[model samples]
Target: MSLRDRLTEDLKLAMKARDQLRMDVIRMIKAAVLNKEVEVKKDLDDAEMSRIMTTMIKQRKESVEQYEKGNRVELAAKERQEISIIEAYLPRALSQDQLAEIVDSVVRETQAASLKEMGTVMKAVMAKLAGAPVDGKLVSDLVRARLQ
Candidate 1:
């Protein structure tokens, strides 16, 4: 089944099971997609939807960090829960080793011998991993270390 279909089904299950948190997250996702579709005047494909969910997860992670810094442990915990729910809809994240290997290969392919070429290498690496969920920060660090 497609991701949209899965979300619909899960939303139904959440409603039936009285899973308020799951219900809230799924509705938030639908709303985000709907808003984007309205803005772009087109329906988003699965890949686009995946990107939206990934962005949502990234935002939640940043919120968690801020909440922790403010000593709002409860809010941070809630954001973490939301993050876990959102992640369930995305592709599995690449392992650190897997991402490092990809970065290394891209570096070799592009002959990015120095930090000056880091931008080119980063673009190539992100393109290579386009369909899979990855942390941009991690990718940057890997490329930086590899170039160094």
Candidate 2:
């Protein structure tokens, strides 16, 4: 099923199950997707949807850290819960080993010889990993370590 259809189905189930957190998160995702369509004037494919969800997860993760730093445990936990719910609909994440292997291959493919060529390696890696859920930051760290 398409990501949009899956989201709709999950939204209905969340409503039936009376899961407020899930309901809210799904609604937010739908709204974000709709807004993007309106803004871009086109329907989003699964890859675009995955990228949006990844951005949402990244935002929530940052929020969780900020809340924790402020000693707002409850708020941080809520952010974490939202992240889990959002991630459920995203593509499967790559393990560190898998990510490292991909990064190594990308570096070789791009012939990235040093840290200065990090962006070249990153672009190639992102292209390779497109539609797959991998954190950009983790990829950057791995590439940097390897290149350095």
Candidate 3:
């Protein structure tokens, strides 16, 4: 089944199970997907859906960090719970070593040499690593380390 279908099914399950946290997160995801579809006037494929999920996860992570910094532990914990629920729909994350290997290959393919070529290298690496759970910041750091 497609990601959309799976999410819909899970939404039903969450509702039936009275899982408030899961239901809230799933509803948020659905809203984001629907908004994107409406904006683009097209149905999202698995890759597009995965990108949406990634964005949602990123937003939650940022919220968690901000909340923690502000000493709002309760809010941070809530964000963490949302993150865990959203992450269940993502593919297994790539290890740092694996991410590094792919980044190396992309750099080689694009002939990206030096920090100035970082953007080009990042675009290529993201394309290759699409649908995998690789952290963008980590990838950027790796690319910078490799290029410089």
Candidate 4:
């Protein structure tokens, strides 16, 4: 089944299981997906749905960090829970070594010899690694290190 279908099924399961946290996360995801469809006047493909999930995960991570820094452990934990739910829909994240290898390949492919060419390399790497979870900051650091 498609990601959207799976999410819908999961939402139903969450409701049946009385899983409030999971239900909330799934509802939010469905709402986001619907909003995108309305905004673009098109149904989202799997890749687009995955991108939405990835964005949701990223937002939750940032919220968790902010909550933690503000000494709001409860809120941080809630955000972490939401992240866990959202991440269930995303592909597994790349390991540091895997990320480094991909970045190296992109850098070489783009002939990015210096930091000035970082954008070029990043674009190539992101395109190549689309639909896979990768840490942007880590990729930037790797590209910078290679260029230097």
Q: In model 1, which regions exceed 4 Å deviation?
A: none
Error of 3 at 69 (Å): 1.8
Writing each residue's lDDT as its tens digit, candidate 1 over 20-106 gives 999999999999999999999998888889889999999999999999999999999999999999999998899999999999999
Which candidate wins on TM-score?
A: 1
TM-score of each: 0.96, 0.95, 0.93, 0.94
Give model 3 RMSD, 1 decimal: 1.3
By TM-score: ranked, best first? 1, 2, 4, 3
Q: Supply candidate 1's per-residue lDDT for 67.
A: 95
Candidate 3 lDDT over 65-123, as tens digits, reads 99999999999999998998988998888899999899888988999889999999999
Model 3 stretches astray by more than 4 angstroms: none
Better TM-score candidate (1, 4)? 1
Error of 2 at 94 (Å): 0.7
lDDT of each: 0.94, 0.91, 0.91, 0.87
Worst 10 residues of 1 by lDDT: 128-137
Assess candidate 4 and give its TM-score to the true structure.
0.94
Off by over 4 Å in 4: none
